[model samples]
Target: MTSRRTFLFKTLPAAGITLALARHVLAADPELAESDPDAMKLAYAADASKVDKTRNPTWATGQRCDTCELFNAPDGGDLGACSLFKGKMVRAAGWCNQYVP
Candidate 1:
């Protein structure tokens, strides 16, 4: 009979691979949190450039989600999580009225 140690050794690699793949899948497709009700109230935009200055004149240039204190983007990624969005990810270049340096 196979010992517990031997069984674990044989299955550990497979388990690790499965976990890694799952993580990658999740990281690749974060939910669109910006669409949430709270975000909508804040007038969050996926791209700061797309924000209508006419509609929101208070928004100034050079403000971006990636630079905001609430932004949570991974290195080298264009999308990241935000505290306001909860489960969704926002564009690195996105903007909103809640932006803070």
Candidate 2:
């Protein structure tokens, strides 16, 4: 018969540990690069400077993956995961044809 205090004490740390591990797992390293075939298919560039503004007139000078709807920045880092390229991280300053603002 564990008391409520004991239950909480045991549960809280385990829950905290699980949450920490989940974050770590979600922050795993990227599996693809801008030069990959799939990335090339989308015309993804690791640096926004490399994007052809003439072709992507809708892309503004300051637009970046960090601001894109598909990006999932990890701890607000400069490099984070993008839904466009699963299991792969993209630079915050990156751009692509698939960018949605």
The lDDT per prediction is: 0.84, 0.84
Top candidate on TM-score is 1
**What lDDT would candidate 1 get against the real structure?**
0.84
Q: What C-alpha root-mean-square deviation, in Å, does candidate 2 show against the real structure?
A: 6.0
Residue-wise C-alpha lDDT for candidate 2, range 22-90, written one tens digit per residue: 999887886568679988898888888888888777677877888899998868988888887877888
Q: Count the backbone clashes (under 3 Å) in each candidate.
A: 1, 0
Candidate 1, 33-101: lDDT as tens digits: 556787789998887888999988878889998889998876748888888777677889988898989
* Model 1 ranges with Cα > 4 A deviation: 1-12, 27-29, 33-35
- Total clashes in model 2, counting residue pairs 3 or more apart in sequence or in different chains: 0
Ten residues in sequence with the least summed lDDT for candidate 2:
26-35
